[model samples]
Target: MTLGSRLTALPAVMMTPVAALMLATLVVLAPGLALACEDLTNRTQTAYKAGDLATLKDTFAAAEANADCSAETLQWMGKAIVSTVLRSVHEDVSQGGSLQAHETALREARPYGQDWRLEAWLGDIAFERGDFTEAATAFQDALNTLNDEELTPTAPDTAVIEEVYNKAEMARLAAADYVSAPTTRSGEPGGLAAPSYRGFQPAARLVPVEFQFGSTLVTPKGLRALRDLRDALRASGTQSITLVGHTDPVGGMAANDRLSLARAESVAASLRNEGYTGQIYVVGRGERDPLQWVAPLTQHQYHQALRRVEVRQ
Candidate 1:
């Protein structure tokens, strides 16, 4: 089944609304690391594809132990474990999976030096959970990690190197936009700035649709939110729509800036798929603006509040 179909098919006990959607967006957080270690990678991929968390946990533990054969192998294994566990805990019976496992693997990988992948995944988690502040923070940390020349270099393949650069750029752009979400301030009505950057009321208050990490694909809740938005728009005499996409501060800012635009494009694609023909316009804001301002609060609340796309009439 497709990612969306799989998510919808899962029982609530297997996956909560937030975790299900959040994980779905980050299916490729590790990118091509799997290609480097096909044998170990296959076991993990098979378990995930089958939705067998039991097999997944054991397989990961085995891979974690056996895969320390090389520098890249060790780093990739830890990265994949943390990346997958963040999703698996919200899936079918953990059997043996837990966040503790992720930490354990990370502690083991400390000998390999920090990598951008770990920070990137954490940012993605925060972003998916609706926490923009943390997402931005993590993304920034990932970028800083990338600055270290000592990190194991990619293999001699030019294509892989280019892909790495692109992903990094994407993360940077994404982080740039994500940071804005926390710092943005609105201009008061009857003053110099626009009345409200938050967009039209009622619609703004209810954003039912939540996207998957690094993707514009909406979750089941996001779909329902869109349905409600469609009806609301029709009623409001909205001649056309402007989809503004935002990114949690993760990955490369350039990439995520495009990601913000991609989100708008993705929504527009969904509209088209649904046969929406009105003047559907998309604006990729690239995380330059945020609907909510950052303040001292729980990380979860910060995550849930940022990492969203807003609709304008």
Candidate 2:
């Protein structure tokens, strides 16, 4: 059916007064412009159905430039554009594309008014980049919005809300730790890696060092604690220290393994910079050894506790 006939066939409830006013304005502007808008909208619908992101992007932009398009038509085009961009971002992440590379695309979709989804994507980008403070703020903004279903229609509403909430809480904890306390030294059960060594104790004592999620750098407070350890080891004449790195079970096993080991290496480097001459052994167990293992639903709550480097002397 032609676009005009389809419009006329739509139920009255489907046509808002704003949409009707837009149609009247389109008619007054120029019949040819209205026809052009209809043609562009048709092309957009076809591209969206075919999952032709390139064509959908082109047609959406064309429609946006033409005021002859009805409000309803533009709204549909906006949804299509945002959906296409979101799918592309997911694809990029699956293929190991840098998160920063697709951040601009998500930001560009902001004009489409899917604030919840756009903010959620921005939060993910910040989280992956190790900017926990920004991530927490973005996730909080997403939580304040009420239309996550508009973006992730396939996922269960409760699951989506829970996931976003967990991420936000995790980010908030990491951000808070970064600002106030960088070193966590306690006999906390979930904090220990429980290395294989049997009762291996040295004269010097070292504790597990907490790290920000997806990060490998030693924090300033952690550096200070390591300096103290270095001085104690020197006094005790300790010959070697074991550093075991760990992460929460959030990402793929292989990636988590690499990240865990990277965290240990970062600590070792910091110790070396502090002039600790003792031998250093580093191990990356990844998520294989969690001080406390919880279900995926509650994993984020323990993420900060899990992402740590154990210093055994």
Candidate 3:
């Protein structure tokens, strides 16, 4: 037999037990490796869904290091990283921090390569951070990338993809809002408060608010407190009130800034509707102001307490 033929036939002459052992090893280790990869994927998904950017980041880093990850898994990991970054941007804007931070996070996630959803998310973050110029640029980039070829119908077909696209559009609109809305001073104390209230003792009022993941709406409990506060302030003859919003250091500063503003605005709107005629000043402190000074608390707990609107009468 030729040398190549002999080499090919060598496998046929191998003992059945040896062949079986090789197959067994593959069968044993393959599934184990797959399961480990699956577990990591699930962890990343959970963190992304929960808007837990920090956890998502850690999991993505671990997944990147895993040799067993398939191409599809790696792609998913990349998407997760980008999504986490967008979520971080949203948190930063909601909390009223530097838009530069959001930009930095987006750049870090850019390696996932020309993701329209991610670009849209960046635009939205910029818009919320009051950087209309950046927001417009991001929105344009997202729209440029999106085409009918990428569109999919139905939840089973490409739900995640569609959802990401929707988020991009939302970001675009948010940026537009930044452009059209009345210019408000970012949490920075604008020009010294008129001297009228200089000597006024800052009356403090505790306001409770709740936030579900990915939502800024106030709960019934929050609305009730705001209504009561409105009535009390009207009767108390206070000249003005400071509406301060705070959040936990779970997401990026931009996202936290936006969330804080939303909370404060919700409360302020309720107060205005309830006939509060006094001056209302809104401030978003982001994660900078924590009710508790302790470190190492879970993001969930810290968020629960941090996502609050306090009224200083």
Candidate 4:
């Protein structure tokens, strides 16, 4: 049976008055299932605040299927679900699966009240249908109709909100970067390859130097690779080198940034100590320019890989 139907089939029976009392006591003591609905509500609000439609949709789906939900709760739950689906439609119009899923949710939630959420969903649908003006109008109307007074005032932990906000900002910036400087044939941003300077030519490049986890100390292999790079740069008559450090997403942004910077500095120091007199430009991009999105690496592996430095002439 389908998950929803199976959930609905669960017996609410009490064998006896005493048993019913015990069940009631259990419900009072452990209201996790009931509280899940509330959690969904909170998560939906968070998703909206962060402009994260994916999380919003997942939370809304959970809330809709909640067996403990009452008609009153369903009203908010329905609205939240619809809002999320609409956002998804706004993002990717060709996602027919998402569209159908939202349609199903809307059907389920419609009885609750077609409030601002419904309007927002309609706007999203219109946008997906390539009616941008209608979508904008709908979003504006939905925003205007939001019952700020009715919304629960309990705020999430400050740190979490800040983190989410920062990530959203980062994603927005990344999108802007991709649009402004499209990836070139060589996989670097903009259609230009790294300029050949000094003795170093693009064609003679070896495997890009990588780092150990969360450390600035270069591996013997990494050092050897740098030696080769130094020789090439010297031969090519390059006057300067740029050392860039990158990290995978594993920790807080500030911490990652610091770590990446430190890694770059460590590499630069090593190069300087080796009597390579060329000017060095050190930069760190912590977990921002990942080689892999949704890394298969364990947290330990990810952190290790992030602790790496690269050299460019």
Candidate 3 residue-wise lDDT at 60: 66
lDDT of 3 by residue, 199-304 (tens): 2222443345555554567655455545555645654577788998877677899998888887787677777887778888998877777663222234554466
- Model 1, 1-313: lDDT tens digits are 2223323422332233334433443355354554545666676566555555566556556655664335555454444444354444433223433333354444343343354455544544454444554555555444444433344232212332232233332232233232311111221111001112112122222233457777777766466656655555543455777787777666787997888888778777876676566788777766567543322345543444455667766
Among all candidates shown, the one with the greatest TM-score: 2
- Tens digits of per-residue lDDT for model 4 on 1-313? 2223321321221111222222232222223336646766676566655656567566655666788665555555444444444344333433223432454554444443433444444543444443443444444333333322242122223332222222221221122111111232334321011232122233212123456656666665466546655555554466877777877677798888888888878777866777778899988888787543221234554444445565555
Q: TM-scores for all candidates?
A: 0.34, 0.41, 0.33, 0.32
Of candidate 4, the 10-residue stretch with the lowest lDDT total is: 172-181
Candidate 2 local lDDT, 121-218, one digit each (tens) = 68767776567767766775665442233433333244454555556645654553432112112321111111211222223222436676788865
Clashes of each: 22, 0, 23, 7
lDDT of candidates 1 onward, in order: 0.47, 0.58, 0.51, 0.46
User: Which ten residues in a row are the worst by lDDT in model 1?
Assistant: 186-195
Instruction: Count backbone overlaps in model 4.
Output: 7
- Summed over model 1, clashes come to 22
Candidate 2 lDDT at 65 equals 82
